[model samples]
Target: MIGRFKAELFLILATVVWGGTFPVISELLSFVDAAYIVGFRFLISAVILFPFLFKGGLFLRIRQGLVDGFILGSLTFSGFYLQTVGLNYTTPARSAFITQLLLIYVLIFQVFAKRKRPTIWNVISTVILFIGAVILVDPFALEGKLNKGDIITGLSAAAFAAYIIRIDHVKSEGRMVSILFSQFVLCSVLGFTLSFVQDAPVPIFNFTSVGFILYLAIPATLFATYTMLKYQPKTTPMRASILYSLEPIFATLITILFLGIWPLKHEVIGGSIVFFAVILSEVSPLLRHTTKPEPKN
Candidate 1:
């Protein structure tokens, strides 16, 4: 029980770190191109984790990690690149809501891959979560027209969903550290290459932006990736998706704190609904079993 709780806590912390990145990255985009930001941030993360790639007697594991990590890293890169580019064409709120369609993609993929349909509770929770997301983002204001950026962000969500499923599939492979290190390195290389190809202007170094970049690289990229790779397999992919849906909520709070943006009434209501839906999903199974009558011996 304690172990599961700890694992869930770690997942939550990872999501929180991810959520915190929104404001920082949004700010950084003003001074740096999206590709360069991705490049330097991931390069820093690779540097932080580089030493672990050389641990003794892990050559076989490293080989496997290289292949698996490259596959995973490619998917990750696609998601981030599309989403960041999409951000240029859409509002952050719209981008966030669309990006989170990852949950729906994961659920659909799980149904097909596992050859099992979701439980009633799972389906209900998903619906409720979707409703909350709609409320949070208020897409109705968009008048049913999705721009190019919205479509790209939606595709990014699909890539992210595939990435999540891939992580779950590869959990049996050991050497998580090596795998994640490889992923960071690959993403860094891709980011830098794309930045150069696009001729994105180089980011001018300043204290504030540099600090934000380091924060993103260390806590958001390095620590968050480590915890996610280490602990996410402990939970069902659906549950993990639900947990991650909390990112928007966290992002809202962080935005309020850093930018003095107040949460609107709908955001508060939507965030609460999503939060409780997640809690119910986590606890319902336990409650069901506990309430069952004992069988006569």
Candidate 2:
């Protein structure tokens, strides 16, 4: 139990680091092209992780390590690229609501992939979690046709969901380290190659852009990726996704810190609901364990 919760804690921290990206990237896009930003961030991450390629030679042991990493990497890059571009087309609330759909996707996959129905509480928690995300983002307040950004962000959610499931399916335990390294390598290639192909403007070197990229490369990219590879499998993919659903709440808090924007009433209420949903999920498992009959002497 202790070990599981520790893994959960690490993932929570990873989510927090990920949450910081919204504000950081929003600021970065103004000064640097999004493609350039992606290119540089993942390039640095891949270089740092290059040493791991030789560690234990796990890549060789896990025959599919590079393949799995490529799949995960494509999903990762797609999620990021779509979300970044989607925001330009959609409101933040819409993007939040859509991205949080990733949890549902995982649940859906569990049903089909495992052929196992969710427990009652799992369903309950999922419902509550979804409601909380909806309330927090409050897409209903926006008056317009469903735009490209909303659709694009929803696609990003699917990509992210696929990424999470792939992590669970990785063949070798801790072999995901190799897979993650490969993912970074692929994203780095895609980032730079795409930037050039798309004719993105050459990014101006500045303290702001450099600082943001460095922050992203290490803590957000490397640490966060490592945590996901190492810790996410400790819990069910759905539970991990539930915890990840907190991304918006963390993003809201980040806005308060960096943009000085206090959350509106709806955001406060929604954040509370989402938090309660997470608590319910954590407690449900414990309650089940405690309720089991005692073993015979």
Candidate 3:
């Protein structure tokens, strides 16, 4: 089993990589339809994981892998689909802010679905995270009316929260490889189908676009997801969500470094607060410091 601190670190690194992906995808979207890139990304990852089918006792438990992969793939696809669809109706910033609601949805699921109560630190971290997300996204810049896009994106957040909860339950030794392979295959098929159905424009094939796809396939999806599956189950769902919330903050720093785009004042302030929230969650156990009872009293 993975140690808790190591798992948390791996997941945080996964989120950091995930955060840095925005610019790559944003650049690709200029010349490629969303569906095409999504399809290719999963297809490449699926191909890379194909060799794992013959290893890791995968064949012994192939059935379990299939079922769990379908469950996970479907949830992941739904989350992505909802957010993609919602983006058509809402601004990206607004949608991003709404997606952070996953932190709350995970808490609710933990309490209602798993019969686990949130620690006080979880509640505090969540509140701080939400405030930071709102400030970072600056939803006030958008229209005052509640949009359909926000509602759809909110559902996406719930789907992702559910995915997080289910993954911890289903992850097992020797099966993650097969499960990941199956998920990639399923997602590739769905992405291709969605592209066809939407009649998305043909993707431009160039060194830059191909490089972007390879980066996403190899690093963002394959490596990052591998770490997530291998490590996230060792930590609390609340902790995982809180760490993922650091994505926007990482994105801010990445932008400054690579794109030379400086953040707005709100973005900087909000990002700082969000980073602090993750720090608070991480050190919460240390803060409790409960005294031990007298021996043999």
Candidate 4:
């Protein structure tokens, strides 16, 4: 029980760290292109983890890690690339909220790919989540036109969902670090190549930019990924998803701090609804199990 609690707490902290990146990345984007930012961040991370690749027995797992890492890295790079590009076209708050659609995408993937049916509570939570997203985005305010960023952000959510599903399926034991290291290398290579091809502006290495990049590469990328990979398998998927939903809340808070503007009334309401829906999804299962009568021995 204590171990489980610690794992959950670490996962939430990792999510919070991820949430903090939205504002930092948004700020960095002003000075550097998205690909450059992604490239450097992953490059730094891969460098930090490079020594692990040479550990005595680690070579044995390289082949497996390469295959799994390629798949995971592709999904991760796609998600981050889309999210960063989408940031150019939308507010951080909206982008974060839209990305939460990943939870719904996971459900859809399970239904179709795994041939599984969602529980009634799962359906209920999904509906609530949808309504909350609609309120948060408020498409009507845009004259029925979706922002390009929102559409791209939605696609990013799907990619992230696929990533999550793949993680659940792969369950690569004892080689997670190797897998993650390979993923960093792949992302770094992809990011740098894309940056050069797109002719992204070279990032200025001022104190401010360097500080943000260090923060992102160290805490947000390395620490967060390590904790998530280490701890997530210990918890239920629904619980992890619910915890991840908190990222938008943290993102909204950071956004408010950086922008100095309070969220509009609808945003507050919609974000609250989405948060509660996530909580309900996790809670309902516990409620059902507890309410069931014990069978006579």
TM-score of candidate 2 against the unseen true structure: 0.78
Estimate, for each residue in 1-297, the C-alpha lDDT of model 4 and write its tens digit.
888899999999998888888888888888888888888888899899877767656677676588889899999899998998898888788788888788799899999999888887789888998999888777887889878888889899999999988987776777776788788888889999999998888888898898988888999999998887789989887788688778988898888987765678887888788787778777768767787899999
lDDT of candidate 3 over 1-297, digit per residue (tens): 349988998998998887766656656676677667767888999898877676645566566589898889888878876766665565444455557677778888999989998888789978997787667656676685446776787798999999989977995566777777777778778888999999888888999999988987898988898887678889987678678767766765675677666766876676677667666665666554443345695
Best by lDDT: 4
Candidate 2 colliding pairs: none
CA deviation > 4 Å runs, candidate 2 = 1-15, 55-64, 87-98, 144-151, 227-247, 287-297
Where in model 4 is the C-alpha error above 4 Å? 1-9, 230-242, 287-297
lDDT of each: 0.76, 0.76, 0.75, 0.85
Q: Using TM-score as the measure, which candidate wins?
A: 4
Candidate 1 per-residue lDDT over residues 1-297, each given as its tens digit = 677789899999988888877667777787778887778888898787777767665576567588888999899888888887887775454566557667667778889987767766667767886786667556665785547676888789999989988887786455777787778778889999998998888787899889988987899887887787779888776677667878877877777788676666875786676666666565656666787899999
Identify the superior model by TM-score, candidate 1 or candidate 4: 4
Worst 10 residues of 2 by lDDT: 89-98
Candidates in order, TM-scores: namely 0.80, 0.78, 0.78, 0.90
**lDDT tens digits, residue span 138-249, model 2:** 6776774445676778788888888878767777665756776778778878888888899988888799889989999999988887788779988887688678868777
lDDT score, candidate 1: 0.76
Model 4 per-residue lDDT at 246: 88
